[model samples]
Target: MTERIVVVAAALYDGDRLLAARRSAPPELAGRWELPGGKVERGETPEQALSRELLEELGVAAEVVERVPGEWPLKPPYVLQAWRARLLPDSPDPKPLQDHDELRWLTPDELWDVNWLDQDVEAVREAAFRGAGNCATSPNAPAPAPRQNPPNS
Candidate 1:
């Protein structure tokens, strides 16, 4: 049986920049850089889950703009749904609200610089090609390869 995994990320944008978090003490996987998000909760839609996660992780509200692309049925059994969001024009300043350490507004050129969680790497790769304008395109780009280097190689 395929283990179903779903993650919903808030594609937070401030003009040409997008917000990304460096996960510090993530409950499971710490020290990874991921877009602020979390697993979809039971009985909740992906959008609802995204909003909740944004609030929980960033101490800010997320008004979803559009569903970004680059989703796939991945190994480790995950089905991801990403969303675009407009941080309120006068959004209150963000505070460290969760396990993630720091936040940054990253441009497309800097997208690949962070070490990403296995599933989120594809989402990051897609961001550059899709532009920072929040295009609600489908999964037009190829998914990223699974981490297959022999353990401790």
Candidate 2:
């Protein structure tokens, strides 16, 4: 079986807002919004690849906060994964230096306003929850808790 191509997407957050970018190249995906990222190279870890991609595509230094907790399948031979990322404190504001033509920082209430690439919807939803402080639907709903590892033996 062919090895699946590994790709990474960054749900870049600035406090309660998440970043989204508009694709500018590749006729099929152009005009659709997606989290900024690119393929992981053979020798690089996903985090390294994501950092490199963010630098190359958005012109900023980023630090991966955490993986978004799921794997998403793309077209055959490709699988996409997501991570929470943030710009370094001293890094310049991100710009669309490649891949994308526009960038927007979206508040949680504005998450559904953009036309996202279909494959990205679920990942975006999860990222939105993280940004919105674990938005619980009902007052009685249990508040979301951060994952904790079992106590050391």
Candidate 3:
């Protein structure tokens, strides 16, 4: 069986607002919004990979707080894992330095305003449900866990 590749995404937030990035490349995905992040390199932990990706793609430093509750399938052999993140106090504001062409900060109510990439829609919903103040989690649901490498890695 082919080994699965993990792509990490950040549901980066400030107060109650989440950051959304608009893709600018790979014509097919251009103009679609997504939670900014990238693939995990073999030797790095997901948290490390996420931080590096944020710096590379958004030009800001971020702290990956916890893993979002669920995973989504990408193209064959690639699966998406999202984490809740926050900008570091000393970091500069995010800019679309790479894969993205635009950035927007959306409050919980504005979350659906952007045209999110198809594969990212559910993950974004799950992230907001768990992290955004306006979206409540059920008492029976487990809290998001801190970053950890997936089992059997």
Candidate 4:
């Protein structure tokens, strides 16, 4: 598969709960879970793409925290950069607006509970869990720690 530089956000609300999006029907990993963001269009700043994505996919605009810097450490082709964003209190009800089917709030303990995009698995391990479920209610969800590979001879 072609890996591309995607800009996703580990969006959170009330400071502790993360926002996860459920993919639409018949997705490669349909009914699976993922953070609410997407690929960074050319010429668009990672920050801009993230903000635009949230609106396009979830129907809400959020303030970019500009915390995490640089692209996430993934193999070439699938280069990605993301940030921690805070949803405004005035945020709209985030119903799935595009490829997504639903939205949810999950804690660290619950993050690894579902199948995530191959690239996003590591992010969940790194991002700290802030709060418990406040809105998570879907068909399902879990995290597997990264495995270390033995050095080749």
**RMSD to truth, every model:** 5.5, 10.5, 9.1, 9.1
* TM-score versus the correct structure, for each prediction: 0.75, 0.86, 0.87, 0.71
Q: How does model 4 score by TM-score?
A: 0.71
Error of 1 at 64 (Å): 0.8
Ranking by lDDT: 3, 2, 1, 4
Of 1 and 2, which scores higher on lDDT? 2
Q: Write the per-residue lDDT of candidate 3 for residues 1-153, one digit (tens) a residue.
A: 999999999999999899999888888887888999999999999999999999999989998899998889999899999999999999999999998888999887777667788888878878888876665434255433422321111
- Candidate 3: residue 93 Cα off by (Å): 0.3
Off by over 4 Å in 1: 73-75, 134-153
**Which residue pairs in candidate 4 have backbone atoms (N, alpha carbon, C) closer than 3 angstroms, thus clashing?**
3-77, 16-131, 112-142, 112-143, 113-141, 113-142, 114-142
lDDT per residue for candidate 2 within 66-148, as digits (tens), equals 99877888898988899999999998999999978889998766665667787777777766666446532332334333223
- Model 3 clash pairs are none
CA shift of 30, model 3, Å: 0.2
Q: Alpha carbon lDDT of residue 108, candidate 2? A: 67
Q: For each candidate, how many residue pairs have backbone atoms clashing (under 3 Å)?
A: 0, 0, 0, 7
Model 3 ranges with Cα > 4 A deviation = 136-153
Q: What TM-score does structure 1 among the candidates reach?
A: 0.75
Q: Relative to the true structure, how large is the alpha-carbon lDDT of every model?
A: 0.69, 0.81, 0.86, 0.63
lDDT of 3 at 38: 95
> What residue pairs are clashing in model 2?
none
* Ranking, TM-score, top scorer first: 3, 2, 1, 4
Best by lDDT: 3
